[model samples]
Target: MGIDSTEFWIAVLQIIAIDIVLGGDNAVVIALACRRLPKEQRNRVIFWGVFGAIAIRITLIFFALSLLAMPYLKIVGAVLLLWIGVKLLQPEPEGQGHEIAASTSLIAAIKTIIIADAVMSLDNVIAIAGAAKDSMGLVVFGLVVSVPIIVWGSKLVLRLMERFPLVIIVGAGLLGWIAGGMTVTDVITREWVNDNASYLRWVMPVCMAVTVVSIGKWMAARARIKPAAMIDLADNANK
Candidate 1:
């Protein structure tokens, strides 16, 4: 695809959107892994780690595209994506501390960053593959654009998330929308979806977004209530 083509740009935007939405975990992993490194070596570890991650992600994107070409695999991937969206809406688990040891060794820090990135990037790989479809160039271009944001601007993104928690909610809803889109595009269901549920092309995504936000909000409220109730019970018992 030519760089000037509208389709190419659209694909690039889609990939960028997917990367940003799904990249929070990767940024967190990178930060956590590199936190223990000496200041002099942290940047080196991040650079190499992100470089390795990009290479691995490119390979995985191709592999994911091939795997998603199968009849029912898109459906499976959509379900996984939906689950991931719902999980994102929930509060992060407490006390899930990393066991990574403080290391001044550049190699050790780099290895940690790479390994963590690889493990954390499965969602990103699948999502980006779906967004890029058959366009390898779009996949590469999008990652190239997003990597700098993730590597250099993660702190900014994190601050935004903290300041406007709604961004996370919106991001989760977007993932649900993407999941809905992926579901209807499966080869096995595509014809039926087109014929019988054509409106679902748009409706499904909206519904999925709403459903994710509503369910997530409810779950988060419940979580907050439970902790408060426990504390109240403890106070009463003490009295």
Candidate 2:
């Protein structure tokens, strides 16, 4: 856990990567929540809101790191990571809108930001905790470094996601890779895995990543079909 250690830097990079992959929606939420505020007050709201949100997130990550030490919690976390990764890979349906309420007052705006961050960052919490590997220093450093990215680099990241899309796919796969490792390292399974199936450490990442992509693509296809089917039914009724 020394700062000079390679493991430490890797954890830091992982935490920051999680932030970049997952923080765009939160930036949007902040913008929406502050839309009603005066220009002068908007920055203040974002500052305090992000500060509060980070504190809450770090606390949640701490709790998660603790929970992960229990027998089956890491397995549950791994499953959740798979679900989150698949969700990330799925395309948003057209015309989707965030129904966030804009606030006029400073306190209300901050409150809105805090609430939105808490709600939106559950997946973030788990991902960051997994990356931190119980290192509070690394968690703090990574999150602190990522704040500017979340605040200032929001538009850039969103644009990248829209243009390439492969960025998101790669990020999702990274989550699966983390989850794959987590599953084998769980307290309930770790000893057995290490003794009986050491190879799974390297193999599961590929399996989980492919599984997430395949399931996500299938769900997207099904979603597209439903809309198309509805359009066809409407056409028949018109005829």
State TM-scores per candidate.
0.78, 0.78
Q: After superposition, how far is residue 203 of candidate 1 from its true place, in Å?
A: 2.4
- Cα lDDT of model 2 by residue, 1-239, tens digit: 89889978877777777788877667766777888888888888877766666676667777887899999998899899999988887665644435545477777778888887887567888877677776777766766765776677667778878898888777787788778878888898889989999999879877987888788778877667354333343775786
TM-score of 1: 0.78
Instruction: Give residue 133's error in model 2 in angstroms.
Output: 3.3
lDDT at position 196, candidate 2: 97
Instruction: Supply the global lDDT for candidate 1.
Output: 0.73
Name the candidate that leads on lDDT: 2
Q: Which tens-of-lDDT digit does each residue in 22-121 have in candidate 1?
A: 6756776677777877776777777777777777776777778889889999889888877777877777544433464665576776777777677657
List candidate 1 segments past 4 Å from native.
Answer: 1-14, 96-112, 133-137, 225-239
After superposition, which runs of candidate 2 have C-alpha atoms over 4 Å from their true positions?
1-12, 36-38, 96-112, 224-239
